[model samples]
Target: MDSKTQQTKWSQFLSLIVVFFFWGFVAASNDILIPVFKKWFVLSQVQSQLVAWAFYVAYFVGSVIFFIISLKSDILQKFGYKKTLAVGLVLSALGAFLFVPAASAASFWFFLAALFIVGLGFSVQQIVANPLAIKMGSPQTGAHRLTLAGGINSLGTTIGPILLGIVLFGMGNKEDSAPKDVNLTKIEIVQKEYQTHKDELAKNVLELRQDNQDDPAKVNEVIAIVEKNIADLDTQISSINQNPGANENQVEAYTTALGEIKQRSTNISYPIGFVKDHLKEVKMPFIVLGIAFILVAIFMLFSKIEDPAKEEEAEIEEGSAKFSIFKYPQLYLGMLAIFIYVGVEVSIISNLPALLHTKEFGGVLEHNIAPFVSLYWGSLMIGRWNGSINVFNMSKTTNMLMKFIVPFVAFAIIIFANELSGKDVSSFYIYAFWILAFIIMSFIGGKAAGKTLMIFGLAGVVMMILGLVYPDKEIAKYFFISGGLFCSIMWPSIFDLAIAGLGKNTGKASSFLVMMILGGGIIPLIQGWICDFDKTSPEGVMGITWTHFSYVIPIVCFVYLAFYGFVTPRILKKQGITMGETTAGGH
Candidate 1:
């Protein structure tokens, strides 16, 4: 590449990175929204997840419209990238502004509508930005550039949960008292009491453990004896209370005795369970905060970008009517690849927080801690960053090997970790496995675009199946999070492969690709309906559970993606034009 062309390529790469960052921030915020809506709207588990369905479904719907427009014989040749992006920005901004009203009225439908509009805007942005990134550089460098963009996008994901957590959960007291209106002294008292309770619980658990080991057979017998004595003391105190002539000092002594007895009972039982239960009770505010955070992210995107269509005209003249890009079989298959990739990605992230919060799966951590789901985002960032750097260094075959091996190893680690910890493994283990998988996949992606994605897609299907079959919560969460590792490269790889050679027609084809994001919307809703339906039982048999149904979404998405990976690229080669080329459009 020449110096001037190199500079232009870098600039274009930077612009797409910004777009990716925005999308990552906006898209990942939906993870926070699901639990938030569940709390704010008092929705059922399935109902709350509709928040994701409502937002992502727009990608599919909007992309279809854009795909149709692109078929109008080089519509992008008439409009250009700058103009298309500007229009998308405006629509996204309008979507963000809608949140203010949605929040004020607490209207769920309004929020969904706003998210749909935002999805439409993002669809346009995706169409324009993705192809532009590839065209500005060589295919070797293009994936790297997109991966860098994915990294910045992960940064936004990291910040989003923390920022929203502070806004929502940090402001509240656990005792059902509104921190916003409470006096400082009362707040301090509440905090002190909370800390005291936590400390006391820790001390009691240690004491109970010691007691249990001191005499395993006699511990329960001793506990029952202590409980009976306490109950008898309580009855004696009540009898004293019934005496009309009881002295004030006698009453004070009885009260003190009752307090001592209660303390002894708590020590015997180990109060850690009670402390954890109280912490769970304080999660409502955190849920609300998560919702607010996403609204703010939507606002940020809307304010920052503009609609590309309104900005400028394309330098290229309209192409002859002889060639039609839409008629190509590879192009259609490529669109399917994009669709499935997005669906798999969305399903993976959306389900993580819920899995961490499910008690049946031995969720010991509180939901407030669930926002740390950003750790998965952090892992993705690491992968994309390394993938970008390695894109230039590694050969296709070497990179492909790493991608396949990395996820497999990560899955193994997660399975081992879950087994070791058994039912008591912390949620942090989920994040660890995710990071490990991402690292391996990044090395694997190298420069072989189509094959890299194919590997990831197949891995996604395997992980989803594992999650469905496993009854263990920790194992299920591990598989779900590991799906992220396999999924990390599918989006950019599939995109670059699909639009490989469309010259002047790249922008229009890009639009078609963006429209496929509607998969995010459609798949999640379908999953939601499936989950809801499963919860409804017949007379004798149990209903389908979320664990079983959740697998269906990713399985369906990956099955398509796997097909696209193995078959779509070869089909593209047969077409005598890559996804980036302006060939005679064929179906």
Candidate 2:
């Protein structure tokens, strides 16, 4: 704990953060790919979200495998952090390589399987990286150092979309956009969902007929309703196909139906119409990513990265009694909080691309989407930069000044990033106002985990509400984008709170928290499903209109998170733990 050991090992820490950069790079990159994939494969917004599902669920799956293996022995302790992380990278590398065949074959499911493997590698990397970040610095400053690492992760997120955008669609000086083309025969997703709805309608009708054998009229009325829905969807599909064009409502409602008027493409941006060329474009990005992973894995294995001394099974923290996982309310509640927290952060950016495509919004085509996506992810970077201010180890007055100054500095970085990627930076000038407000809120939130969580969670809830209510779609879109601002530091706050008093159970609790990263996958798919809810509801509004209304899902998630923040402190105090006192966190 002396000054020498207290200083963070800058060189070693830099080496470790490379993995963090790539994690955010690939993750934020997923949002960009979601729309591209939707266009490429004629996928529903719901089906398109399988990109996130496949990637994040692998974290749950990998963590489970790790947990099972650890019951016999702690894997990190046995293999050591550096080697374990290397192995994870290799696993991810193999997964990335799988993308080649997946793209070459134009198989969406295969791409998912490959992405799942990438997520599995990240699961291991996440496990090692979080603890390793803390160990790289002083015990007292470990959490602050982890915040700094999270900042690096955010940096990755900020640039990921921008760079990926250029890689996908270079320097934005383009001609006319591609025609909306989708394959009719390959509209299996629509057919599958249709069958599901049909089966449910049939089941309901059968039950009603059984109960109302004497009242055939009741069952017949329900049958008419079901048939009307079926016919409506069919007519909508047929109208668009016969004319070779359709309104956005019809397209969003049954996106895969555009497949009926399939045509080839001449533009690489719209190359999905030309199946062969478009599928070929997909391989290069992933293959390049895979090679980078393998090279990093090799460097990590050979590099002189230090591993902290491992603790024994009996490593009880001072003044703490061993408690079963059942006794920890914060642990369980915080698990779900972590789940919801990760989900909302991810879903906002994931679905924003679709939101941007609508006429009510900017109606920007795919190439134009990078700026908004970049800004959303960049918002996280801004907040993380502020959160990492403690890394400066300056005077209290300087720390306060840094808190105010650092966020703007991060904003500058974001602006610079957009410019570097050859994107329009004018719209970003106004977003600085939102960042300014977040800076003020950050002052109000301070350092306490519970207070920060409650405040930020509620802020997220309000932003979503405003996004729903705001009349101007142009300005309203920023409300949705501001979600990243609120979500910035939630991961650490929830993580520290969750493991606040776990003592010897700390490592195990951490693993479970990592498993909850699957929320990243689950929430977006739910929102996308809501976005594609093509039928009319009892309220007489089209469920497809829920694209604008799907903000409700994120709203509910923030509400629970705010509740968790409000209640978890009281829950932990009963076990004699202070709210702010806690362990490290990772993205």
Candidate 3:
């Protein structure tokens, strides 16, 4: 309740945001998986979106379960924040571990289950962390601390796609030295002859189809001949490859050729009956992520993390007079705000790969989509970083300059990392100007979470509208991607508004708010269904182009958020509530 106790705990704050980074990393990386799953399984848009559904729906389930348990007892209060965090990390690690089996089996449902486990872990973390961030510093500047933590979260989002791309696509990877199992002399002869035969046979089959246009019998005969040749060539290559006397050169050539055959063949099947090469590669990064979570959990067990609730036990007892968090309309409305905000944010980013892959949209190559995904998530980091500047202990002038500089600094970091990963970032340079607009909006609304929330929410709505309107224009891409920039500050802003005066109920309120993460699950599914435009039906009935029309989901979401932002402050004022001492000393 006092200003002195409210000063930010810098070291503890830094320690806490590690979980935030993990949340962002895994969440954004789901975008990459969506397209991959769709292509591999030949899934409908709705079917592939089970990725988002399985992952985000866990939050609602976990939070509801947590809330029910708390009806009898406060779990965080009993277990303590540090222990709760460690447990969450362990759960997350367990989830990541599931990816190993999921990928090994190449089971799509297994992958969903793995993501669900991860989401459950994140739910607990969100329940604990959101309230914890607010309580870490002065009640006035609590929003700023959360914003700073979100900036760290955004950092993970920015890097996740690029790094995961490397793992999945083998981009920029160097070939290892050739294996020493090949019969070098015979290997060369076999490989050369195989390639010659393969090419000639493939060409002959194509010509047979064309030349035998009126002779099905002749076409079948030529196809049979080519198929037999291919089968015989494979046997010869296999015999040479398995020979112990084979040299490294021969082994390498044979290995490379076999891989090419798989790549070129339309109906390629994995011999292992589970993980294929690409799926296995994708599984590697997640397995490593699982290991990292375990290590972090171990560290958390030993680390001395303060529980803000414990420090204010007496005040909490006093504030405990109110048991039901829903008594406050702001809390309930804010809960919906969090839900819609998350739903729209996830829907846009998760579907971006699909949108870009469409011939009607950007049509970006599968492997090349990482950088654009990075841009969407990175844009969030830029806005959050800008908002984070207010939380730092700096002169007013310094803060202003940094507000402008920090986003572009974050932007530079994204561009640099992406460019190094082989993505051309030149088109994204214009986004910095859009970022400048974000900066201007930040200063215009100052530091009031509710006011700024309204402003940013409206801005988000505008961006979505532009994206929908000019769905095909190059400029529309900027409009759609800039939605992240507008959305960056909303989580902290809405959280700050919703829990402003809830006192002891803040913890319960946090759970309810976290439950709204269900929106992330449902909204994308709805968009996917809409994206399944029945081309067979008369046009325009579904609203817009299937891809573009789906964006309307986000537009409606932002509209609700903007209205919430506009009304919440007035409601708080009528109830004599004000966030006491903001980082900028306002409101």
Best by lDDT: 2
Candidate 1, residues 1-587: lDDT per residue as tens digits?
44224433564456446666667766766777676655445465567667777777777776777766655644455665666666676677677667666665566687788778877777777666765655555554554555556666766665555444444455322332211123434223223333333443344344444553344545555446455654555465456546535465665454444434433433343232222332342234324433443554454344423333322235323532343656666667888777766766776666655544432343222234333445555445444544544544578787666655544443343334323322222445445555655555544543566666677677778888777677665456567766655666666667666766665565556666666766675566556555444234311123224544566778878878877777866876886755431110000
Q: How many clashing pairs per prediction, in order? A: 37, 3, 7
Clash tally for model 3: 7
Please provide, for model 2 over 1-587, each residue's C-alpha lDDT reduced to its tens digit, 9 standing for 90 to 100: 56346778888888888899889988998898898888767677788899999989999999999988986777877888889999999999899899788876677888899999999999999988988877776777777768777877888888888887887778754222221123443234344334434443455345444543334564465456655554555665455456445455554446433221111110112122234445566677788888999898888888878888655334733323454667788888889998898888889888888777653463456777887888888888888887777555589999888888888888888878777776656656778888888888877777788888899899999999988888867678899999999988888889878988777678778888989999999999999988775323312133324577788999999999999888988988888888654322349
Which candidate, 1 or 3, has the higher lDDT? 3
lDDT of 2: 0.76
lDDT of 3 at 384: 74
- lDDT values, one for every candidate: 0.55, 0.76, 0.74
Q: For every candidate structure, what is the RMSD over all alpha carbons to the true structure, in angstroms?
A: 14.9, 11.7, 12.1
Candidate 2 vs. true structure, TM-score: 0.81
- Which candidate model has the greater lDDT, 1 or 2? 2
Please give each candidate's TM-score.
Answer: 0.63, 0.81, 0.79
> Between candidates 2 and 3, which one is better according to lDDT?
2
Residue-level lDDT tens digits of model 3 in 142-178: 7667666777788899999999987787554211111
Model 1 per-residue lDDT at 431? 56
Error of 3 at 17 (Å): 2.1
